[model samples]
Structure formats: structure tokens, C-alpha cells
Target: PAARVVLVERSPEMAGFAHATLAHPGNAHLGDRASVLTADVMLTGKARGEAGLADNSFDFVIMNPPFNAAEDRATPDQLRKQAHVMEDGLFESWIRSAAAVAKPRGGLAVIARPEQLGALLDAIDGRFGDTEMLAVHPRPEAAAIRIVVRATLGARGKLSIRPPLMLHAETGNGPAERTEMINNGLASLFGD
Candidate 1:
């Protein structure tokens, strides 16, 4: 199962990590099957022909887009502002970008704040359908903090909402194996 992986990062830091990971000698076996592209997909996604990203070329695309539009604060940190705050239709732009590269009858998945569910669906609009959603709660009976949605391109079937995924158990332990691995310094979401 060495499925080809294409990582597109808008942030320089993320892009660097992806590039290094793919290019590292440890992963040299992947060779041309993996790629890391740095671009602001929202603005230039349609014009990435030079990057060899052709239209409807991918079987599936997954995205985690910025959900906040905290524009009123006027923060001085331009990078943080650009990363968190959203201009009008920014979510739509990201969704459209993903749809443009997804193959027909393929799939798209997005993870975003539970509060942004409406916006997420609206962003995909008519581009994708047959939506399925899973709510992620921090604890049992807790309100959902995040939502994971998957949909098929060009399929307009009725939407289905699945059961929630509780991160913490009733004993208050979170993702047992992952937590243990992290505590042992054997696994991490961010690497050294």
C-alpha cells in the first residue's frame, strides 16, 4: 500500500517539512510517487499547470481549511492573520480548488470546526454530494468540537450523518494507544 501522496501546503513551514520528509534518504524509495507543492491554493489553484496539477487528476483530496474570519481584530502579525482570518468566500475558494483536481466519482474529505459545518457544506455546494459526516467529541456526551465530512464527486445522494467519535473515554483517557505512544516519545503529531 504505497499509495501516491500529494501534499500541498500554503505555509512555508509546513511545506518545508513535507518536502524534507519526501526527499529524505529514508523515504527515497518513494521517489517520484510523492510530492510537496507550495502554493496558495485559494488564489492560484486554477493556474498550477506549471506544477503539473492537471484538472480532475486526483482520485481523492483531503483538506483542513482555516475556519475563522476574525477580521475585526486587525492583528499586527500578518502571518497569523492570513492563516486564521478568512476573506469573503475563502472557504468556497478552498473547496473549489479541491473539487477542480478531484476525479469524477472520486471522493473529498474535510475536517473543520463543528460550528463551521454549514459553511463547509456551502463551500462544496454543487461540486460534491452524497455527504457523510462524523462528529468528534472530546468526551462522552460532550458537545462536538470537530466534524469530519466525506463526499463523492458528482453524486447527489441523500446526506447521511453518522455517529460521533468520542476522543476521551468515560475513564477520561484520550486515544489510549496514541496517548501512550506520545507519552513514551515513540509517536507524535509533530516530529523532531
Candidate 2:
């Protein structure tokens, strides 16, 4: 069954496309069990506030936010601050919002690039407890390119690193395993 999810995207085109492609198919079995909301991460007041979402309502919050350092460099300017820099602290705001709306012991999962790991950890530290890390390697021989992290609210625990997930084929078979995982929702294999 699909859990209640609130997906935020800055681009309407990407959001709508995601709703049509991913949400529709991924939640087909859990009809009316999912809700997809499209809005800019920084400007969405409802999402930032509890009025738009019930307290302790969700089971999980999943996202793959933008990860361009040049675009969101740590700077002091306002526009860049909100857009790229965390001046407006949109990522932290969203994380807090997720923690607020998520049920006790609910999980928050994010897939971010390797470079963003430090910022991500800094942003999430202390706010959400029981953090765990899973590195994502593009190929067996290559360094990890991305990371998958899961954290829960209000509980303290040691961080556990999982085995790296190899996404690309050694012989360059066009990411065979990763492709299947994306196309067929292979995450279900983990049984949550």
C-alpha cells in the first residue's frame, strides 16, 4: 500500500510530469491513497505551515532536491540565498515541516549527490534522530556518486552504513539494474 506522501518540486513542468508518470503508476494499487502537491519549495506557505498538513500525518517524506553547487552556493545575497544558499533555509524548513507532519517514528528519506552530504548532515543533525546512510555507487569500481539517507524524529541511535548500491553495469550495459529499479519500482524488494 502506498503511504501518504507530499511531493514538492520547484518546476511545475517537472511536478506535473512526475504526477502523471511516477505517482499515477506507482500508486495505482493504492487508489486515492496518495496526494501529490506541486509548489516551489521556498514559496509554499501552506507546506511550510501546519495548517496545510495535519500534525503527525505522514509515514515518509522522500525527495531528490536540486544539487548544483554553482546554483546554490553558500552566499549572502537574498535571491541566491533563497535559491541556492540556505539563507531562507528551505531545505531545513522542509525537513522541519516533514518532521512536524510525519507520524512519530516516521521516516524521512532523501537521495542527494555526494558533494551535498556534508550540508545534508548538518541540516538534519539533531532535528531528526536515528540517521542512517546508504551510499550509491555508479559502478563497482567507481566512487560513490550519491547517497540515500533515512532518519526518524525524536529518537537517538547510531548511524549505520549499508552496503553500496551499484547502479551501473561493469561492462557498460546502460545501467541495467538501475534502469529496472527505476522503471519497475524495485525498491519494493526491500520490504521497507
**TM-score of each candidate structure, all chains considered together:** 0.79, 0.71
True-structure RMSD for candidate 1: 5.3
Error of 1 at 62 (Å): 0.2
lDDT per residue for candidate 2 within 1-192, as digits (tens), equals 445446566555656776786556665865565555665544334544533466677777776665556554766655444444333354676676667777888878877788777777777787677888888777788899888888887768857777677777787757657546865886632225
- Candidate 2: the clashing residue pairs are 72-84
Task: Report RMSD (Å) for each prediction in the order shown.
Answer: 5.3, 4.9
lDDT of 2 at 123: 70
Model 1 clashing residue pairs (backbone)? none
True-vs-predicted CA distance for residue 146, candidate 2, Å: 0.8
What is the Cα-based lDDT of residue 69 in candidate 1? 59
Model 1, runs deviating above 4 Å: 24-31, 44-46, 71-75, 176-192
Return model 2's CA RMSD, one decimal.
4.9
